[model samples]
Target: DHLMLYVTNGMGEGIEASLLTNLAINALRNARRAGIPIADQAALADQAVYAHYRGRCYLSVLLFDFDLTNGRVRVVDAGSPQLLRLRRGVVEHVGFEAQLPLGMFEETDYVAQEFEVEPGDRLLFVSDGVHAVASPKGEAYGEAALARAIQSTRLLPAAEVPRAILRELTGHRGEAMPDDDALVVCLDWRGRPADR
Candidate 1:
């Protein structure tokens, strides 16, 4: 099985989300037709965004195509700073440097890269909102807190990781709402069964 996800923000308040949604779908089609990677899809989306929308927006794309026959997991990602990988109760950064978010450069080329994952591992994807909160004390919740949230819940069920992060974020902010829409996605890899 395979999966693709798109998270976009930093747009002016005029149907930006809708445009990004449409952009993702159309870009996927373009990627398949051109035999390119997700980064190319991002470039396609960027061109579409620049052609129609005139606002600054950040688009983060994550695609993982699992070849169940060989236990190979191909992960393609761009424009996201923080991707957490949980393995055996430990959380580590996936360390993907996004080429650039969509709508930044009209001629930019997005490079979709690949990575491998093991069975029973979890990948946590977050939007910019997770780290964009500024407290009255002027401190951003930051990546350290996010790491802790995942570390603390590494042993728990996969469903609880995002909740714990949000809970911690809210606790740190103490009544300050994030300016952007926040999204969290957790993928748990169970691996292909040998019986198959």
Candidate 2:
């Protein structure tokens, strides 16, 4: 279980923020009822148990689950960043096709896709804020940099990849404050023997 978390500043103030928070919670509850497994059960449970405390703050969540016994990987992307999976040295994005962000609509559905995770495969999920970071020269960090960041960490444990990306981003931006929230979740699947 590896998760990267980040949140960015928003232009909306006060009341509007509350509305979005409520909407997001309702949307996630709807997703749970609709059969989308949240991957991190404890975290979701905590959110449900204390949802009232925060009122409604807009945020996104990204989850990654790996079942070593079956070589299956499950991800729940809720208005977060796109998740990338690197298998046998090739990198590709995985998750439901574009769906509404949590809390924006009354009813929403999310699709879960599974891919065989070989012993050396790596997966990376990142928040949009990371890609949104702009350099002094004015170019956004974009997909190319992200892909390269993941590739550099291909041989490391799944948990380290996300941190590597964060470090990379920090190096790129120097002292500037990130414009948005960013998070990364990485999972490395090391298959186990059927009997184990």
Candidate 3:
């Protein structure tokens, strides 16, 4: 019962570091409230602070919450990445109407969207860093690439799609390490059968 979270911050060193860290913290807090188990909160907080202090402008986070009896995902996007949902071989983006980045407001209310995941359905979340990676020709990875990657890996298990996308990114970017941190999270809901 693990829920995965993928986060990525935009360009510029130390620009959105603090805000991203705060967003991660808020996301974790909200997840915990939803009954997700987060080990070593203090350590994570420390790492978040360090990420901000080190001026890591491009921050990406992939977290898995291994508790999903509730079939809900709590997500907080702080100007990071886009979330895509795949069902019956079609891809759709889950739109976040108007939510501010984490840590920007003290009493910010992050709206959590819930999807009744059916068996064999998959969800893909990735940071802009991945999409921002460009080739020597100055072409971006782009949403089309993301969509193709997801479609190609749709048959595979949830865990493998992220890795596949990473591999694809390498080929597209022609580098092992991307300019910005790239994070990916794939969630597959193998729902339980209804009792007679």
Comparing 1 with 2 on TM-score, the higher-scoring candidate is: 1
TM-score of each candidate structure, all chains considered together: 0.80, 0.64, 0.65
Query: After superposition, which runs of candidate 3 have C-alpha atoms over 4 Å from their true positions?
Result: 1-76
Weakest lDDT window of 10 consecutive positions for candidate 1: 3-12
1-196 in candidate 3: lDDT tens per residue?
5555545453445645556556566646665666534333322433444445443332333333423575655444445567787889988777554344433333444344444566777877777777788986779988888889899998887878899998898889884456787777787877666679
Predicted structure 2: lDDT: 0.59
Q: Which candidate number has the best lDDT?
A: 1
Candidate 2: tens digits of C-alpha lDDT, residues 1-196: 3222222122244776555555545545564566546543323432542353342333454434556566665655555577777888788766564433443333344454455667766656677778778887778988888888888877777767778889999888778887765667776656685664
Write the residue-wise lDDT of candidate 1 on 1-196 in tens digits: 4444554444445686676656755766677567666656666777776666553654555555566665465554555535778888877777755566666667677665667777888888877778767667979877777778888877778787778778777788777666766667777887777884
Worst 10 residues of 3 by lDDT: 37-46
Q: Model 3 reaches what TM-score against the true structure?
A: 0.65
CA lDDT, every prediction?
0.67, 0.59, 0.61
The TM-score obtained by model 2 is: 0.64
- Kindly report which residue pairs in candidate 2 clash with one another: 7-181, 8-181, 23-103, 24-103
- Point to the candidate with the largest TM-score: 1
Off by over 4 Å in 2: 1-59, 63-68, 73-76
Ranking by lDDT: 1, 3, 2
